[model samples]
Target: MEGMALNQLFGNAYFGRKVLVTGHTGFKGSWLCLWLTSLGAHVTGLALAPNTEPAHWSLLGLDEVHDLRVDLRDGQAMRQALQEVQPELVFHLAAQPLVRRSYRESLLTFDTNVLGLVHLLEAIRETPSVHAVVNATTDKVYAEQVIKNGYPEDHPLGGHDPYSTSKACAELVSDCYRKSFFFDGGPRTATARAGNVIGGGDWSEDRLVPDLVRAASTGSILQLRNPAAIRPWQHVLEPLSGYLRLGQALLAGEPVEGAWNFGPASDATLPVHALVSQIQAQWPGLRSEYLPGPHPHEAGVLQLNCAKAARELAWRPVWSAEDTIRHTIDWYRAYYASSRLLSSEDLQDYVAAAHNAGLEWAA
Candidate 1:
């Protein structure tokens, strides 16, 4: 998928569109920015400066993006940025995204994840240029039921940790704004709940793939707190495709304003140890050591049923667990061996895979 074919994705809804992306400095946000720009969307990124050294946003060197370093918690700043951008499409991905860090900085997590979203939505309510909005949440928004079949879109929203609870609150905030303000003829709003997203360029703290990369690059033994924890994992592009498809639906005046899950197939769900083993198989130097200790409360098992996305959006993950691990390891291997970026290549490969799978968006 390239050139005309790439632009044809999502019915070419993104082409020539003015798009606003919050948290564009973060991992997933950077990837979304790259993909949106590739589809010919004029992107304006609104978020704080990149917090980490060697940030993906800087590495991508996307000079065309109108980058604005504005804090989401600042309502005035959010309003000013939205007013200036007057974006036709919006993707909100900013938040305190870590569970353990949330326990340490619970107040900051709530203020950023919950209140930050309020600021964005309030701004969107006032700025009429925005025709569609997708608020990216997490799979942990569902209460811990440990269900084998996986949590559906209607699963009761609850969270044991601050990060999860705050995202759940964000989901509620989106719903409130949608009904209270945008119910009649306003920006079509929806929420996206994605599972554990692993790919290149995600060097965020406390995440599994990044931690493994750190240990492997430094030749240190990786620590595993909950090796048996099961999570529905997929490449970063999987849920992003779902989000883009959902946005396409909204932009086309289709009725897709609601919560949707973007996760891998049931067979791809695996334990932390299993994922670690797969990564180790790909990179022989990677090693791990299980640690026995009292750790922060994290979900032991979580899965998502993406039937709604499949039925309505015609979205399904194109990569399997093996493909995900292999591509992830290959990416880090290329980056560490030489200063190289595989993001664009990976995106093209993913689009091609989706095209091969007969996905409508790729078609």
Candidate 2:
């Protein structure tokens, strides 16, 4: 069940279809571009330059496709790009996506995460060929609650930090667009909310898995910001799989509404220390210590209840927390070792594993 073929679930729907992926130079978008290319989709990417070296886009050789370096904030350029591509399916993933960074650059964060989405939606409205859209948002969009239960899609949308708040605003923008313009006989638009995604090829600053991988490679003493913080963690592939499924439904003229959550199973929400230790065990003699420091307000405990996605889209996570960590470790280890293996190779192997795991969506 873990070795399912990628095409089995999507079929020939993507073949020859013009697809536009914003933020294609980033981690998640790069992976999606690769998968779309493999599905025989005509893929075009729009993004600012990659901030980090050895990014996933470069790793997968995404430049061979239609890669355009563009900022999401420039609405005119974005609109022009959309008209040029004439995409049938659009996946919106561009944003300023870090919490601490958002604290320092509050205006930039809001402009990118909130207004950038507005620009994208406006472009989609002007482009008539685009029939389906999935705007990738974060689980942090939910306001902090006193309870430990996972947050459902209908939960009060709020955020303590700028990054989360901007995403919540983005959700509101999408909802307004859906109701105001796309209410009937227009493009099907939806937002996907996912939590603390971990995977290979992610070198973003202040992220957990990437920090751990870097420390393990360099034998550096890794400093922990908040070891007790708990989050709903899932493999990157898990939510990307959900996005594809949602796109399929929208393309088929299914009337989906508002936002959806695709999070890890109930028990996969673990403390930061536990997840760090799990990956640490894979690297012998790796030293790490928790150093309590003053940090901005981040959620101590966050989770998502994906019952809507389960019931409506029939989508659920395929990898357990432990398996996610293991696969992440394997990819980074092979990556640092430069053992004559490409990340694209690792991706193919992961898809096979997901198929074998009996993930119906992957099938």
Candidate 3:
């Protein structure tokens, strides 16, 4: 989509608006910053420096973004950053995102995911310029269950590990702040629970796609744990679209201050082994070996019902699971083989596809 056409998206809420995206140095956060800037939004990013060497944030070279290396645990610093930027819209994505790492750094995960959100909300409360906030949680927030369909928004919030538990706690924190503080005269807020997001530029440790990329690039056998585990998988752009749509509603003063699920269709929820096979089909010569026990606890099967987003927000996933995997693998291949960045190309293709699908936000 062109600049004017992209600006017309989400009812022009983002065009020329001052937006704050926490965790802008991370994989998903960098994508969000790129999209927001494409829509002509003035973006201020607040988060710690990128931990990875080939960090996507640095690769993008988004000079327009006001990148501030502020740790979310510091309440005073967060408050000061908010006061300085005075963004009208906020998307909170900063957190200790790894599940396995959370086991070793339980306290750090809790501090960053739970208390970090508290600090941001407190800062939002103090900063009067903010109007709408989208707190990005994860699908693991739902308690373990044996339901066949999928977990809805009303499912009980619970977690088995520190990372999941911290996010669930963050959900609760968002609720407490939304109801307790963001009332009659306060900024509107909502929580977004999305499925397992896979895309290029996500070189995070212990994740499936990055692991596959590393193994494939190094000509090593990929180790697999919980091969039967299933998750609601979608491209990174899928949930970012949902977040932007939700932000559009909140900015429009719509009554959408509650939790919502942004996930793929039911059939897209595939097991770990099956997803691996699909990716191997796209890229030949990818070998793997299943690792036995001694692995940390992870959800076996998890899915999400996005009926609420479709019915109310008129939002839906533009690409199918096959499309998502293909785009993701192609991106990594281009990056490694020829040092080409397909992020901008992927964004344009995704927007065109969404517009073709008649999604409300894209239209």
Predictions in order: lDDT: 0.92, 0.84, 0.93
Let me know the TM-score candidate 2 reaches against the reference structure. Answer: 0.95
Per-model TM-score, in order, reads: 0.99, 0.95, 0.99
Off by over 4 Å in 3: none
lDDT of 3 by residue, 1-363 (tens): 765678788888899999999999999999999999999999999999998879889999999999999999999999999999999999999999999999999999999999999999999999999999999999999999967779989999999999999999999999999889999788999999999999989899999999999998899999998889999899999999999999999988888999999998666799999999999999888999999988889888899989999999999998998999999999999999998999999999999999999998888
How much lDDT does candidate 3 score? 0.93
Question: Which sections of candidate 1 miss by over 4 Å?
Answer: none
Clashes of each: 0, 14, 0
What's model 1's overall lDDT?
0.92
Candidate 2 deviant stretches above 4 angstroms: 1-5, 339-342
The candidate 3 region of ten consecutive residues with least summed lDDT is 1-10
Q: Over the stretch 1-363, how does candidate 2's per-residue lDDT look in tens digits?
A: 122344455645777789999999998998889878777789999999899987877777765579888898999999999999999999999889999999999999999998898888899899999898899999999989855568888899998899999999999999999889988777889999998988888999999888887888888988999999999988888888889888888898776757999898665799999888888787776778988878788999898888889888878887788778877788888878873334566567667766677665556
lDDT-superior candidate, 1 or 3? 3
lDDT tens digits, residue span 1-363, model 1: 776567778888899999999999999999999999899899999888988877889999999999999998999999999999999999999888999999999999999999999999989988989899999999999988977678999989999999999999999999999999999999999999999999998888899999999999999999999999999989999999999999999999998999999999666799999999989989888889999989999999999988899898889999999989888889888988997999999999999999999999998
